[model samples]
Target: MDYSQLRFVVEIVETGSISKAASNLFISQPNLSNQIANLEKILGKNIFYRSNRGVTLTSYGVEVYSYAKALVEQYAMVEKKLMTRSNENKIKIASFGSEVINSQFFEICKRYNENNYEFNLCECGVEAAIQKVNMRDCDVALIIYSDFQQNKLGQLLTAQELELKNLFQGQLKIHVSQKYPLSKKSNITRKDLEGLFHVKKAYLFEGMFSLDYELQFLGIPENQKTILANGNKTYNDALHNLPSFAIEIDWKCNKALPSDLNRIPYENKNLPITCGLVKRKNEFLKEELSFFVEKLIDAYG
Candidate 1:
């Protein structure tokens, strides 16, 4: 309800504990708890599920924390003093890997005064990631592609003088809400997803993008419904709030609410999905960039 309450939500989620957030905020635990309780009262919904171990976001809490974190960061951007820009510490990386990589990048970036350096971490598809690296806009990128697209991907990399370092492989999976009957299964077939709507993200590659491109490319049929989600929040909200399901490769790393979710490898498509790093063939990463690469390699392991 208030600016401080938004700060409280962001801090708690970051620390993963109320008492920790209170300590970081220089306030008593009871005062922190009461402030959050008051905010929940104003919003008319519980923002967290508490236990002795700690707290996790309720479905509504996910939405609140997202907005709260964004608002808090936005508030920090309201500055009256103007400063000149410097390109001295620019660190740019694009990823199609996992949200975990984002966390790692930020954790390392925290070691610096942000005003003294600049960084850009982008979440993007394979082609875009390759293009960024090829154009030298980014020193490197973490990306993924279906083995089905490997040859074409290889040719593109060759033409662009890009190289790939394979890190890990995973089967693309279908994640459904726990209430769905498919959730009980160890694997899901195309027939099982016949009637329920499928959630997917639309990515732009070379100024061309499509909503059903992925399914069509994989030779899968979209008989029921297909929703075009543009970001994490929309994609997640559809799964938690509806009987919809998502077909994705990174079941291991999405920062979604575990709001009764289940994942089963999609038996319908046994595509070998590869997550890897992309960089210019002759590129030698600088010190900070090399640190990021090491962090990503450790994270993928």
Candidate 2:
């Protein structure tokens, strides 16, 4: 009946499991179960058929689920509107690529501090960043994709009703510690990385793995040793301290290179990468968002 219950219903339907939904919603399983049971009793109908595998919506449940999803979305819109009204000058931006984490990006952000506008910057994976923009959870998102993923990514953006603006383009480079044996090389081939471990940035969304272009481009098999890092700092630390390497765009690598780390160009075709900003399609770019985008272009492009 309320927004919280509607949210619970929507999440449960999406996840297909009360336990998983409860975990995601940050509530106890028993509490969620009791609430759902109360809702079902009030309606005099079962919303879902519980099973060992998971819960499935009943015929009546499908109708309720549809309304619940719409209500939840409406509630979100109302909440966002209220928040924006109260914090008129606040800007929410998200970035999935390493370029936005460097000193240059921070310097640009500092320039905006003088204007007294509030800024919320977040670092996330490519898919998450796009999702935030699609949902209007953030004003803008900066993400990176390989050249080969251009058409697919464009199609995905179109499907989400989002628009992309290209910001920078560069070649991919392998980041490794200076102590690494291959650091002396100006460029390296795919065969050179055959047995070495690869460090990759981890995505928050489970089972969403298509964004890892570097690994796929190299034809790295599933059996290969791989290390997952949660953020740019962790990924860079792994490159410096562990016997592993990470593939990153050249502009970002050059801007944030550690003294002990070295970036060697990949001597392979299809090593090009493009970084861009994503926003809702047909949405007018606010002055702050436009200014930030210009700063990013000046810094990286």
Q: Pull out the clashing pairs in model 2.
A: none
* Decoy 2 TM-score against native: 0.65
For candidate 1, give the lDDT of residue 264.
71
- Model 2 worst lDDT window (10 residues): 204-213
Give a tens-digit lDDT track for model 2, residues 1-301: 5668778989999998899999999999999998888889989999989988988999999999999999989989988977764644667878865544545456546776755567777788678888888887788888877766678788889899999998888776777788888889887777777777788767622334254545566553442678788876787787877677776666643334446767787675446667788999888988767777766666564
Give the Cα-based TM-score of candidate 1 against the true structure: 0.62
Global lDDT of model 1: 0.75
Off by over 4 Å in 1: 1-84, 112-115, 179-181, 204-220, 250-260
RMSD in Å for model 2: 9.5
